[model samples]
Target: MADILFQHEPLIRLGAFAGAFAAMALWELASPRRRQAIGRSVRWPGNLGVVVLDSLLVRLLFPTAAVGVALLAERHDWGLFAALSAPTWLAVVASVILLDLAIYLQHVMFHAVPALWRLHRMHHADLEFDTTTGVRFHPVEILLSMLLKLAAVAALGAPPVAVLVFEVVLNASSLFNHGNVRIPAGLDRALRWLVVTPDMHRVHHSVVPRETNSNFGFNLPWWDRLFGTYRAQPEAGHDAMTIGIEQFRDPRELRLDRMLLQPWRSDAGRYPIGRREPGG
Candidate 1:
């Protein structure tokens, strides 16, 4: 199973991404939670473009990717799982959970660190929030995130299957939780306990600085509650709350070239967690 997965990792990931994206796009069209001021024509092109660029860069720079690193670690008896002589099932489950936690921490770090926020803020700069917003990360941030995930996979001695599962699930979950589609309030409340719901994750994109800092988890909802970064809803309410950062309010910033240039265009602004004024 592992060998087969390793050989076909790209196909598996692409298939999952396409299926999830299509599903969410349809769902959004059918039951959108909020009216979009800016249509997909204005945002999807740049957002999708970023996905293409990020994919090509990752494949070109780290051809083997995380699953390959995991296989190498297992062969060399490297990292925690190898040292503990853990059972395969336990390693897989624990590795998936730990990897999610690592990603959660990385998200928070991106907001808290000034320099890192410059790269990550591009994702938050989308004037509208939707499924495409989920995958709209700057290339530099994507590369840095891949490096972090690679290090975590090797250090944990994660199984190749587990790494593959985590990667696919993370991609799918990002699309799901970032969708503009609505869920019934009762259902959304219950779903938040198990997975990050769209409503829960939307608060992270709120224009308000503090709201933007909360609910950083992309795959799991627990880390936010565990760390007290969870915000139930935007202060203005989801329908009324504004999306995107203050710096790039112009629609032109939604273009691919402007997005690529955002990190160099200005000061980190008031959004970086470290830059927030005391009691403001």
Candidate 2:
């Protein structure tokens, strides 16, 4: 199974990514939930450009990435599960869940730590929220996330197949939850019980600091609920609430070049974990 997965890993991930991206793009256009502040022409090029840059950066820095690391660990009988002689199926399920929890905690860390938030806020700084917004993470954050995932895989002795499944599903879920497609309210509520639906994640992208800190889960919705960070809806209706952060509202700053320099150019302390009281 591992050999087959390794042989087809690239194709599998590429297909899932392309398929999810296209579907979300089309759906967002067909039934967008919010009126876009910045048009697709302005937003997509920069967002997708960052994705390209992130891909190149990750490939250059870590040729193997998380799945590759998992394969190696499996071969050497490394990590916790391997040492404990856990069942293959059990290890796979446990790894995927634990990895998801790790990501949820990592996201909270990014928001709480000012320096890390500088990189993460780029994702929140987009003037509009949509599918492309999901892939707009700064390259630095991408590299850091990869290192974290690789470490988790090594520590847990995650099955290679589980790591592959997590990567592909996480990518797809990020796209799904970040999309602008208008899902039915009833359906959105139902979906959030199991996964982070578009509505659930849109709250996290809200300009309001409190909303921005909530709903940090990218794939699973349970973590936020369990951790008491879950928010049902944006205080302002999804269509009414502003997206992006309080600062960097200038359209000129939305360009790819400006976005790359954002962390250094902007103050890291503007947005933090708690709500900012008015009348400052």
Candidate 3:
């Protein structure tokens, strides 16, 4: 199973991404949670462009990707799980959970560190939140994230199948949690206990710095709650809350070129986690 998954990793990931993106797009059109001031025409081109660039760059830089690293680790019996002689089922489950936690920590670090925030802030800089917003990360940030995942896979001796599952599920959850579509309040409340809901994740994109610092989890909801970074809702409420950061309020920043240039263009601004004013 691991060999088959390793051989077909790209196709499996592409199919999953396409299916999830299409589903979320349709759902957004059908029942949007909030009215979009900016249409997809302006955002999708740049947002989608970033995903293409990030994917191509990852393939170019890390041909084997995380699954390949996992396979190598497994072959050599490397890392904690291998050393422990853990059962396959336990290893897979624990690896997935730990990988998710790593991502959660990475997200928080991006906000807390001034330099990293410069790269990650691009994702939060989207003027509108939607499924495309989920994929709108700066290329540098994506590369750094891939490097981290590779290290984590090797260190954990994560099974190739588990790495593949984590990659696919993380992609799907990013799209799902960033969806502009509405869920019934009751359903959203129930769903967030198991996974991060769109409403829960959207708070992280709120213009307010403190709100921006909260709800950093992309795949699992537990880490935010565990670390006490969870915010139930934007203070201004989701419908009325401003999106994007203070520096790039101009819609021109939505262009592909501008997004690529964002990290270099401005100072990290006041959004870096510890920059809050005394009263704030």
TM-score ranking from best to worst? 3, 1, 2
* Ten residues in sequence with the least summed lDDT for candidate 1: 271-280
The C-alpha stretches of model 3 lying farther than 4 A from their native spots are none
Candidate 3: residue 63 Cα off by (Å):
0.2
lDDT tens digits, residues 1-280, model 3? 7889999999999999999999999999999999999999999999999999999999999999999999999999998999999999999999999999999998988999999999999999999999999999999999999999999998999988899999999999999999998999999999989999999999999989999999999898999899999999999999999999998899999999999999998898899988975587
lDDT of 3: 0.94
After the best TM-score superposition of candidate 3, give how far the Cα of residue 47 lies from its true spot, in angstroms.
Answer: 0.2
**Candidate 1 per-residue lDDT over residues 74-181, each given as its tens digit:** 889999999999999999999999999999999999999989999999999999999999999999999999999999999999999999999999999999999999
Q: In model 2, where do residues sit more than 4 Å from their true spots?
A: 274-280
Name the top lDDT candidate.
1
Displacement of residue 78 (Cα, Å) in model 1 is: 0.7
Q: Which run of 10 residues does model 3 get worst, by summed lDDT?
A: 271-280
**lDDT per residue as tens, model 2, 111-184:** 98888999999999998889998899999999999888899999999999999999999999999999998989
Ranking by lDDT: 1, 3, 2
